[model samples]
Target: MFQYVFGIPFTLLKFLLLWFWGTLKRLIPYALRWKKSIANEIVLITGGGSGIGRQTALYFARAGATLVLWDVNPDGNAETARLVRDCGMKAYTYTCDVTKREEVYRVAQRVKEEVGTVFILVNNAGIVSGKQFLHLTDEEIIKTMDVNTMAHFWTLRAFLPDMVRSNQGHVVTISSLLGESAVGGLSDYCTSKFAVRGLHDAILREMSVLDSQVKCTVVCPFGVSTGMFDGVKLRHEFLLPFMAPEYVGRKIVQAVLTDTEVLYLPPYVQLLVIAKTILPTSAQLVLEDIIKLNEATKTFTGRRQDTPKKEN
Candidate 1:
């Protein structure tokens, strides 16, 4: 067909021009990211009891967004709501077990009734088992997958319908660097996160092709100082350091405000992603050893809370 034969050059030209304009906008001072005001936007954050989710909830609240906090821990989730209210923003807390599909759906309904349709849905709830294959129980593995991977599907299904009708919403998936690079003791965790990364990419691409205004963001940050991964350590702390939860939270919220998609935190970590693509198997193994990647999680003692380090 002539359509296929003739469309290549135009497509290439459009891609190049778009790339150039994006670069130029970054270089220019006044011309920059299109900032979206979060004032009064209903933001529902899973795992908002503590860690990164709590911090992100606060970040959005400070920017004038109303908060809906979901967590299995009643005390901590209430505390986060109190903090948001202290910031003079409306906040409602719902104790939820994100690993359960029915619970997530039911809680989502209560949120809609008690708060309103969520303008921003941040899927920050996740759990890490920190156990090698076979060492982990069947339940632990399933729980990890449920919380880390399947919860995204349930939460998105519950909230995305309204977003489609309005065509104005943001979905943030707090993934992990482990999703990009496999590691021992984190097989389940990595698999789950990788699935989420793919999920976000698919959703974003679909939205783009449909000319939908719904924005999507996927974050892949190294371990944070949150208690969720209290004992993970690398040979060179400076080379591959764990980030602060506050910093991670702030960055994720900034990405949403700017509609920035696919974040690799601290910037330099992106080089590792590139290396993963180009480096051979042996070289990649050697690099992994140099960083003590596999050994790092051996000592990991994640926080004991039900939703510890929710996407930290």
Candidate 2:
């Protein structure tokens, strides 16, 4: 079907190049296969009782990691531990609020004593309050910042020293696509997410400067199907669809095993982020409308238990 004999060689070369590239990409994952099994790898996961954290805990347990699970909810924390044990792996549960530095430090100490020094730390605990900027009170703003942004620092400070000393560990951070783009009525949520992106960048830079062997990964997913954002609407499931918790969980395990630095769920979210950075502000606003992203959370109530309680 080529135009003529002149095009024949070019077409053949292109085909050969494509085949080579495809083969190389396919081999990348295999090349990354771990020499040692994940069995007995000490992994600490926050908010492991529900949503993506819960799924990640199960995945890691099946892969043979002894888990240290933390959550504010005792019931959820215990449930995650039970699920891990059901997978034929050891698990320890702790009831600690990640936002409290002392609590996080104490738990880290206990985990070190009980499960050995954590080889992997998954900063997966997060809370969102979907209220308009004007509707947010001072306490609500502080709470959102503390839980969503500050907790990462607390956990990192508590665990990273040991990781640095061991020179063999991984840190997994769970941010959101909303970190790159904001929507109406989620100002506080967006602020918190953006802060996490900055926090992750800073951490990576510091690690690189120190030439630390502690690998880090940041996961930025679009809306997920977890009930954390259940009341939200998804106008287009094809472009920016809600991600399944299980899929997110599996990918995270793969990242930890391979030491990937960053992961974007659904892939298209990366394109959206690129567009946000390249397009003009006016064009981005129009594109945002076309994607119906700003409106997706019109009904979003966020997590049920963590909703900001109105005070007198």
Winning candidate number (TM-score)? 1
Model 2: what TM-score?
A: 0.86
Q: What is the C-alpha lDDT profile of model 1 across 1-312, one tens digit per residue?
A: 323334566667778889998667544442356778989999999989888988999899998999999988899899999999999999999988887889989989988988899989999888887888879999888888899999999999999989988999999999988888888888999999899999999999988898999999898997777787777878988898878888988888888887777778876788888999999989998988997988887887777655454553
Q: What is the C-alpha lDDT of each candidate?
A: 0.86, 0.81
Judged by lDDT against the true structure, how good is candidate 1? 0.86
Error of 1 at 29 (Å): 8.6
Task: Report the C-alpha lDDT of model 2 over 11-76, residue by residue, as the tens digit.
Answer: 787788888965565358635565346789989998887878889999999888999988887888
lDDT of 2: 0.81
After TM-score superposition, what is the CA distance of residue 12 in candidate 1 from its true location, in Å?
2.4
The local lDDT score (0 to 100) that residue 155 gets in candidate 1 is: 96
